[model samples]
Target: MNTKMLHDSICRRQSIQNDYERIKSSGSEANSDDDDHEPEVNVCRISAIGLFVNKFVEGCFLSMIMGRNILYPFFGIYLNAAGNSFNSIPAVFATIWATKIFSAIFSDALPLFGKRRLPYMVIGWIIAASFLFSACLHEYPEPYYGVTNCTRNTSLVLNPRASESAFFYVLSLSGALFGVGIATVATDALTVEYAKREPLKTRDKVLAYLNIAQFFGALFATILSGFGLNSTEYGGSWCTSYIDFEDILLIYGVLCVVCTFFTLTATHEFPVDPKKLMPIKDHLAGIWKTVQSSMFLKMAVYIFLSGCFADVQSSASVKIKAYYAGVQPITTGIVGALNSFLVIGSIVIFTKYFSNTDWRKVTIFIKINIILLTAFAQLITIFDVVRNQYFYLLADETSCTLFLGILIYIAINLSAELSNESQEATTYGLLATIRLLTNPISTAIGNSVSAPFDVVSNDRYIRDTKEDQWSIAYAIIATHVVNSVSVLTVYYFLPKNKFELNELKLQSTHSKKKGLVFVGVISVVFVLAITLIMLSAVPQTQCLQVVGGQGCSNKN
Candidate 1:
């Protein structure tokens, strides 16, 4: 059958099957004689082609994370060590961000080409791979620059400085192009297409699963960078020790290409006649209409602000590591994993309990609380009430930072969900655009805001120095305070309604009862285990330090 006919057939069969299942489960009995004469149930099956397409898309996602998260950091470190300034790093990233604007525009336009998603994805991947490969060879001396005349003979002299500059330019350009190809409009569109098959009730779960997959991909990248790049042991020579970085980039590029091919080969689109396809102008008009919605605008603002805060936090990662000189990359990876774990848990819980309630109120409340908590954390950090090591350890062990992160993440998720209930893909695309726009702006602001403090405090020179650490703390506090107030203002001015509280109460009670019982048993076991470990592990001086740190030395 033709593609349209096949789609119609599938739809009819699915509808009939659903109706039959509903009747069967409702305890309706069919006449015994009529049962034999009934039409055969045609099971709705996902085609082999469909499965292949899904897998291919998933693989591309996996590869993108590997390249962006895993390889990029190592590349950044290498470029920095090669005499590039800290400022240059942001410029490189900014270039990547700038390219995404073009990617977004192209992605939105590609469907007009009459080709399916696969061609766009394939071409993008090819571009990404080619640029990445060129980036790998960036350190090679330029032929023209190396040509020199010596005494009575023509000779070649390698200009290492010229080679370094050439390499940096190539690396930056490749990174920018890669960002344009893989991370922009195509990813958002793919995610929306995936979610279209799922019911609204399961949509959040589907997104959570995708996010989880992305997190796992990031985690894998972190591990690969730690081990493959030999970051700790071989800190020098981008071309030498960091060859694995290029290898990873190439691998991900190959995966992207292969997956794109699979997607093309396996997926078929039902051909829409010109009458059926939405006109380009109409679609653009719809985009404008969607953008003008008050809810969408509010959500867009909230996400932009939230992203600004998050960008600051992300930029602080290197600085955090600098504070703890002996900390390993593996430790950082573990912390990241812990954060993801907590975030996943929070999303699950929120979906289970708060989903049936009014998301708007819950989102607003959460944003307010996030601002409060962010401010509080910053205040504590600035006042020296929370030491960096202790804060990091607490964040690591108990997932405190993860908890806070999820509070903010859930707000953004709910806001996005609420803004475009009907046109989710477009809503999310806009949200992504807002977020992308904010990232570089926020990063630039954060770097600028943090610079004077760094210079004045001479934080780099001081090891184990508590005096100068307050500069960052103050910046964090100021930013969070501003963020909180802005959200509060938005919450106040926007519409308000009493969401049903009883369902939430019931869910809370149920969860609390179960959690209390579980925690009580676990607490006893945990106390015993900790006591045992402590008795075995502690020395007298260390015990005193631990006690003092806990503020229990005098209490006992």
Candidate 2:
């Protein structure tokens, strides 16, 4: 269902983090190596090029060459070939995002070229572009590379790629994710800094702007997927269909470079006032100060648990949509773009009409809407109601685009408010890390829970038997049942509104050890998910052999 970013600083950051804690506890300040360095010139400042400049850049990165959405089918199928389940795909890619905290830390402490985010943003894009270009030249398992270099190539279902080595394929993808990921984080970091300039009442506007940008990116990805790579099988016959997925990637590589260049020219990283600057150690220590607050801790827990609860989506949906339901790429693309448009519309409507509504109610409404809509869609899938492509958009994702568009901004607004202004990224990234870490844990739990129903992630669509349909349906529904439980918890975890948020007193009773527990949790999930994906060349799924399935093809 999802994939994500990676990190630049691993070893260096640990030493830095540990030192910050140690220094904080000992009540002494050691002169950091950069105490005497000249004040940063490029400085952290918003650009005159446009309103929501960072938002625009970040949005472009999301949909443009980033390929996070477009490549989902390809990599999900590829990972399935290598023994990863569809449920596990999001978690695995989420590891890249899990590195955001570290990337945030690297930006906060290291301060590349007297600046925090810009240097990394530019450099990260360069690396990502290189990998995208490199993937074009790499010889993937020829049989599984999709139908003749494009055309309904969303992961060759033949399972031929499973029998071959995926070393280079994984390497190239990883490199791109790592590069683009850190850059994306840096871009977000830039936005976070910019967000600090706004008052709480209007800060959500910045996030809303960013959300619109993402939807815009989604719109682009849809057109490309529908018109470009889609072949006759996926209902892409409307176009001539000349370019391959690689051609798309080649375009992305160029766009990545061009976009990074835009970042350089479009905005300047204004300097932080010297009076506001603190010792690097103090800044790191302040992460504790912010996250240790009872409100922030509660928020982190809610974010983790709500998101982590029921993420048991499997690849069976792909086959069902593509084969059983006969949904074509053009249909998918058209609806996807339309959904993005709806989300933008909803955001506008909400900001204009419901801006005064309690944030808590909005959060709860979104969760409930998610529960009902997703279940309704899945129910249609299970019962074969209509068996048409448009129903999926109308029943399932329609509300998603309408309601979920404002969520990222709300999340940013809430976390930004909780964070110390001086250590914005550190606090925000710490919270984002919790959300990131939840994907894998939730996926693992959801799939494991759904296992008893005999649902599977890599069910081959070529088989025609309907005997296993009920079990798969049951498994899918079970995930929704678990997800519905998350809505109840939000009332207790979140503050009523921004007023209550500002009123809550930060509790100093918490210690560094408790804070490290959160860090430890992050480390555990990151390592486990990465290890699972790394060992994926050997089968790790617990799929049962069903009527229409090739369970775990990588199994020896």
Candidate 3:
């Protein structure tokens, strides 16, 4: 019996030793795999690069739309006078904001058609390009650039009968605006989704690189278009009679289509299991929770005010044309291009060495500078307000653009930190919605307040004197002052180490239907207000330049 017991004990001890070795070996192998996961890391970077390319193309398209190049400015000058482009600014942005909201809402829900973001983006691009193509069919008459038809060699002037072409022209404009809205929303959401898949450290770098690419793309487009804006004397492709503006649309349209194809083919969707899809109720509940958060509300209001200030400043081209005559589109393009370059450089430097604490401090300083400098610039322009050098405007604009770029960088990072990975896109979309509303809201206010002063433009709107435009300038400056104060309030609510803190995961108890109804009511009311302004507000008549045998008049 003793011999048998001893043998069993030895066998049991040997078995235990073998089991321990196997467990130890498995853990060691796992640790080794974790340390040497180069393939996985490399794959993430490759995917990030693809997204970066997609954004670069988007940046180019946006630059073309926003740049003070011949195309966009001509479009503006045709629809309204170059000096009075701000007249219909409210309506244009109302459309954009409405479409953006729909696109952002639908982007998350559109996975039923296939990948959530890519398909919508492709469709949006197609729609946008198609509309631009249609706009190409009509050319801005000769009166837009100068009173004479030097290139076309005809007596044709900018049509006083815009009502004749208003229908189709407006249709094409709507399409472009809506298409841009949808495409922008989808692309923004996709970027957030892609970034979430990366580790935190890598994700920041990825966003930084992508933003750099975006600025580079904008810079490239601005430079390319600057040559075109300057092409008036040469009368080449950028000239009205040459490519006829229609072909330019075709060119950008085709570019968008081609880029869309490449983007669809190159980018991969982050895998989402069907079973993990949240029900509509849960999604609404989640959104409601986010909306109810005090921090988010404060941020939203701040963004709205900031956007108000930005819209006025973005209309600087009009202000420049009104104040400093002979500042041609080419000159505007040059300043815009310079601003883009400086913005890129500033972003690179800001990201390179700034810690979180440093970023917060720098962001505050930039915000203050943006407000003060913009107010000073507007006041100077308003009161005549001082006889300053030409470069003063450029310096102010460039500095503001630089500050804006830094704010965008910091804001994006702050947003990422505030939201969880699961709902990052939705959070961003909501924030963007608030920011976008400022466009129409501020423009409407500017239009209504200055209407009494008759600073609005007529068909042949020409800048007469600084006195005629000071009211409008003052209106814009006042908004900046208001925004400066409003924006400062947001900083207090921002927690310390916000970018490093965990997201606030709230228990959503708000009634989804009530929340939806509330949001709907707000949107409807805002849209109604904009429509009322558009219908009632009349464009103020201003004197026209007497040239090529045309006489100056009160109403064109």
Candidate 4:
């Protein structure tokens, strides 16, 4: 038979085989006590392989996210000193963002090489693990040094001697690999595929479950790193500790290897001929066409703004810690865990209440609430900055920040649902790309403006204060304000009636329209509140200094 005919035959056989297996499995449970009731003799062994493949793929995804989150805090702490330089912290993030963009660019081409998702997943994880392991080799001895503080508790400054540039190169490369593995291609494709499969009726639920898995994985990583690695030490410093950087990388590497083995042994790949796979250019063109849709374009904008705002929060962690002076690493870990936990809970709650509701309205509602929440949170931080009393407000800021994160999470999920099923992977990939671009651009801009104030400012400016603390707070608030406005503008200009908003409502679905209207009014109130807070609570000159001494001087 010809190639096309052979392919058709294989497809037919697969369909028949799948149906037969389904029928056989459906009846087997009824005869649990009958040992003689044999399973279908001719049923393809591929089905069993497929089940394992799916589970392994899922595990790989879980491990990737968990490993990355677990590694981030440690990596950040390791590179914290670099923040004093040309702001290497943002460069680390930019590495991640750049890798994601590259992943987006290339993920669609995987099929052309007769490869499936599993290989990319495996290779990406392995590369990540290898690069991470390299970070440990950079460890060198730090000579003991002393510090003197009159009022506060003073301790020794045991700074690690600078490892070779290759160490940082490995660190950044590992981050890029991790980003490529989890954020760019593999995870997104897996999500879309799973959504297309089981629990056929509720694809959104499938997507939500994926996010739930990610949240738990991230939480686990954070807890383990915080309590397991950071808490234990060979001495006071992480470099000299027993659970040092290399050990962590080794553990992460082992996990990735396990994930790879599981994926290879168990994951299922659909039977598609390599000859029939579309060309990379064609696939990309298809993606371009799908992104041209107005809804997809709006969704892209939403993702971009949301990602920018979220990155702003991430970029502010050092400042938040400094503000609390003497805060434990686990304290930051707890905040991170809480953020993920609340985000998961919010997604569940929103999904429950908005069941079967039109996705567009849900998306709009989430976008509005996220913008408002973020704006309010930024204002709160601004107030704390002015008062120079941020510690008291940490709990509130954490909760509110998590809530905003949840809203953005929901928005992205809803955008995934809004896209056509056939083009789901491509559409979501494009959205991820947009997020990747926005995050780095916003981060770069924030870091650029804030870095000068952080590194160059005279000590007398704030009675002998480190400019780093003030710079962080300023960057966070400024980025949030910009992102919030961008999101609001996108929502306001979005087409109102492209998709029926009422279709999202189930019998139990809450009045999303009312909720949206309420959120909209509240958003306006929050924006106004933020304006007031900026004007009243924060000194204008302080704000100007924070904004890199720009002309917006309200300093009294």
Candidate 5:
């Protein structure tokens, strides 16, 4: 019996080796399913999006979205109606956007009442809700109470009340922005842990789906802000029901209550051991080390350069669209809603089809796509053939924003890999903070470039002459070209592909203190510059010179 068993085992092994050699020689594929077995279902599956299906996940998602997007289409619309330059209102508060870093740092370093994220989130939401509700109490100056029609009377926007209203408006917005920062920190920290636990090959897809909750919140907010508030102030309402302060208040007020409820109930966290906690200085030092590492330094350089140059856009584009292109408020709302819808779709496509695509190639394609779209949009202003305002629609802000979201998704994936399990929030916070801080810098740089252009003067749009159109169009074209070139300047920074990126597991010994310091100094200066421009944007300031245009009122 022993002799028979030994002989059988030897024959089986020989036959298996022969089959392996045959398959290798023939270049045939033999996957696990060669025997017709099905792939096992994993938690990372897209159907696990869990919005309606999973209540716990939905709560955290709601909190994340509220702070990030609750004030989208309508807020800008109100600013326009009230004759305030968004440049002034938003620029000063650019630092608020970067509160993600602070939020993460505090959450990691000093737990509130011995808890990490929950106490901070609850308190933060309450503060945010208070500020927003207070803002609702005081309506935008009477000029903006009802929908204002597009006319040459840019002076209506110059009312002294406009400046006062803008001041309060920005204060409330800043407070609200601060509150949501904690929400993002908590949610992102959770998401990062989940992504790390997933299998490496499917990690990106898992992270992408988890982020859909944020996108869905954005979609919901966009639809409400756009479809509900058809009164863009520049254009007439498309629906019989126009959005006033009350409606805007109600939507956001309800949003706050729901988000608060979710945050209070849905989130779960393990208690931290007091003895296990690291000092704040040590935690920060770890992050600084990562920042000085080779991979992160490269990405930081690219973010600084590209964010400053490539994404610059004049705030005046809104005024141009409304009065020059004859784009109605309803039209703006429709476009916003469409863009939000496409953002969700873009993420889905990126995860499903291009998850394994070359990171460098994907970056190149999206950057080029943005440049082309921008160039074409500018050309819409120059050419008479496609001068129809609706043709401006074909310029496709959707594609530019859509690709931008995918690019951010890729960056987040890469950033997660560079992070250590201990310093996850720190790594993410610093990177995201740099990204946020750059927007104001880019805006300031673009505004400086646009200093000579009459994109927003009363004389330019009110006169409505071909000369004004050509000059503004030409100026934008020049800026577009400059931005497009800058995109090419940072191509060397991104890793070539996934294989190379994953191989960078060793910590870099060299520290980039000087470069980091220089970047930090420049960041402060530009943020201040943008903030100052908005602060001095009162009507008396004469030619405000921000994205909103030459003055507080669209006037000279």
Candidate 6:
């Protein structure tokens, strides 16, 4: 009887394994978004591997590029040294917006070449890395000055601020390239295309892994940036010889090139017949139809409102680094790496457990608490009311708040329901455009409000008075408070149920009317004017006739 029981248990286990494989193989038929057929098992396996490798390699390349930008505060100092600390914010916004616009345009157009995304992906990576490489050509007139407020006799005298150079413009050009080259907005659509080939259960698992991998990539980038770019200790100095921006770019560029090759070789996209490829006119029509969907509009509005805060965290991190004691380049890097690691952990937890639940109440409650705590943290720091070091606490709070605040996953799901697989790239790209618009708007508001109070605009961390420090802190606090309000909209507006077919079939005539065209144009004009006017108002310092430096090109 014991032998019989053991044989029965083994038989049941084998049966369960075979059933699981059948469910996976039948996924395409059950969740059929585009077609009502089954994909061959071998083809499905190949596609899954391709997607995994593509994402991993993309992550590696992204990490290398981000490593160079680990010293954003320093970059801001350089801009200030050039006489207008805020000059690049507008450019950054414009480039990002333009890239989204192009990515949408290209996503549809590139299919004409018998390919959809892979070719553009390769080209975009190359362009982004190549332009970032231009930073290598930049050389500060003086070496990077340590920002210490020490009054000790042995302390080094404050060096003059770096003067503006053609290299600055080159860096700007590179940013534009980067803006166009970082083609991540299309990755989700690609993932969905592959997921469509699998069954429901298998698809969910694949998507979860895909998201985890992306977050892991971002975390890796942060860690890589921290240690790869800056020299933590060199020749007994905290600040010593390290890789230059250009050198970092060169390394990133090479890695991107290698990754691009891997992507092209490893990934196999479903073949599209030339006859069936959507023409330019049809593509535009599809985009218009997708835009008209109520789901798309709501998602866009919500994402725009919440996404603006995404840029604020970095500036806030910079503030903490500037004010906190002993928070040098290495410290900033370590904190960033740690924060990213936590972000990855948060993503994993949310994807696995919290994602399918109606967490609306929970999310709002958390946001409210975070806002209060964040306000308190900033206020105490600004008022000089507390001498205790709370950098880690503040960073942790900021990370948790952001992770809970934004609802990109929900937005993406909503978008997918409104769009067919063919138009997924354009649909998601449009969302990306909305998100990109937030960057400039937030930057303009943040900088303009803070500009009047910015007393110490150069590279030095010293303040003549504690009031100067208060101004920076207040600006950061105000920005946070204003942006935080947008998170509440998600709780209020987001639907409780996953999108269904019945909702898609309903035709709302109101959606077809292009209402935002005039308002959007006006908004664009206004934002550009505000950003340009503010940046121009900041007085630029004239370049001294230092060797290998241009001596004041702009007389204005």
Query: How well does each candidate superpose onto the true structure, as a TM-score?
Result: 0.61, 0.80, 0.75, 0.64, 0.79, 0.75
C-alpha-based local distance difference test score of model 4: 0.46
Better of 1 and 2 by lDDT: 2
Error of 2 at 199 (Å): 3.2
Candidate rank order under lDDT = 2, 5, 3, 6, 4, 1
- 31: Cα error in model 2, Å: 36
Name the best candidate (by lDDT): 2
- Candidates 5 and 6, the one with greater TM-score: 5
Question: Model 2: clashing residue pairs?
Answer: 5-96, 5-97, 43-269, 43-270, 43-271, 44-270, 44-271, 45-270, 234-329
Total clashes in model 5, counting residue pairs 3 or more apart in sequence or in different chains = 4
Candidate 6, poorest ten consecutive residues by summed lDDT: 541-550
- lDDT of predicted model 6: 0.50
Q: List the residue pairs that clash in candidate 3.
A: 136-246, 380-385
Tens digits of per-residue lDDT, candidate 6, 1-556, equal 3433433564576567657756875675555332323352233354455556556655554443333234343453322232223333433534444355557556755663567777776766667666656555655444234344321111342343343443464354446345334455445567667655554323344555665565556556555555554442210123444554445556656656765676677676667656656877887776667666665666566666765553443233344434443234444456655655565566566656766556455456556666666666655655556633446444444445355413434454455544556776776667666666665555545544444444224322344266666666666676676757766775765555332222432433436565365237436744674455444334442121111112346233
Q: Name the candidate that leads on TM-score.
A: 2
The list of candidate 1 runs beyond 4 A from truth reads 1-116, 140-184, 233-244, 266-276, 313-317, 323-325, 357-401, 404-426, 456-459, 462-467, 470-476, 480-483, 486-556
**Candidate 1 RMSD to the correct structure:** 17.3
For each candidate in turn, give its C-alpha RMSD to the true structure in angstroms.
17.3, 10.4, 10.7, 11.8, 9.7, 9.1
What overall lDDT goes with each candidate model? Answer: 0.43, 0.60, 0.55, 0.46, 0.59, 0.50
**Backbone steric clashes in candidate 3, count:** 2
| Candidate 2 segments exceeding 4 Å error | 1-46, 50-57, 60-68, 72-84, 140-159, 162-170, 233-240, 457-466, 505-509, 535-537, 540-556
lDDT of 1 by residue, 156-224 (tens): 323324323433544544463554344434554555445544443345555555555555555555555
Evaluated against the true structure, the overall lDDT of model 2 is 0.60
lDDT of 4 by residue, 475-535 (tens): 5556555655555544553333212311221111233354445335434533432332233
What is candidate 2's CA lDDT for residue 143? Answer: 32
